[model samples]
Target: MKEEFQNYIDYHKNKGGTGKLFKFELVEYKPGFLKLKGFFNSETLNPVGTVQGGQINSMLDDVTSLLLIYESKGTIYPNSTNLHSIHHRPLFEGEVIVTAEIIKKGKTIATIRGEAFSKDGKLAATLIHTALIMKSE
Candidate 1:
């Protein structure tokens, strides 16, 4: 885990927010790419008995945004413009590993791709996320 992101996670870990709910932990990282592990439990399940699509999307959005923020050294703040997601299989309550990488980054926009895998290493969902870049002062 990188120092900056580790600090961010530590700072938010006990804040009673969604980070705590999802239990996101950095697994691996490099420039322009990273992998995260998340725990999904009964709280994340929909009535159909699988993790809800919205929860998965939230994970995708958070991971992608974190990557962009990190790659920019916190200079490129981004507001999500769109998130295109595909559900390959239903994810149940358990550990999920998500990987995100910068697809393309430009002055005014960025594109990121992310994939979520179940504990068994099966691809469960994927996302293509776009955001409008905002430079920090």
Candidate 2:
């Protein structure tokens, strides 16, 4: 299922540098929950020997958005609400695992909670995001 989804996204969605350049693996997925792991290279690192927060946040956002897109079939999608991210620690240049779960889903919006961990399973960051489901005419 994930391979098919990734193939579809890769062929259909015009993902920018992060999506194309980085290596992301689908760790797990179910009816309303999804987990992904993103590998971070030197290009994703900050000056302090740690991966940039933006990169981690972006990975969480991307995975959560993917979950939303997979759920909402026939609709235009947008991030209509803010994503609140909390950085717990720094993830160095290595393998980072992130997981997202759908907390709630509404007609026009959905809420997802996600978390990121370092290679050693250390908590790195967390995020709560609101995704907007759109209708296209």
What overall lDDT goes with each candidate model? Answer: 0.86, 0.77
Candidate 2 segments whose C-alpha is farther than 4 A from its true place: 12-14, 73-76
Model 1, 25-137: lDDT tens per residue? 88998888989898888999999899999999988888888788777777777799999999999999988999999999888989999999998999999999999999865
Report clash pairs, candidate 1: none
lDDT of 2 by residue, 79-137 (tens): 64888999998888877888888899888888898899888998889999887777633
The TM-scores, one per candidate, come to 0.90, 0.87
Residue 25 lDDT (model 1): 84
Candidate 1 off by > 4 Å: 11-16
At residue 103, what lDDT does model 2 achieve?
A: 93
Q: Looking at candidate 1, what is the lDDT of residue 115?
A: 95
Q: Residue 21 of candidate 1: its Cα lDDT?
A: 76
Range of the 10 consecutive residues with the lowest summed lDDT in candidate 2: 7-16
Error of 1 at 57 (Å): 0.6
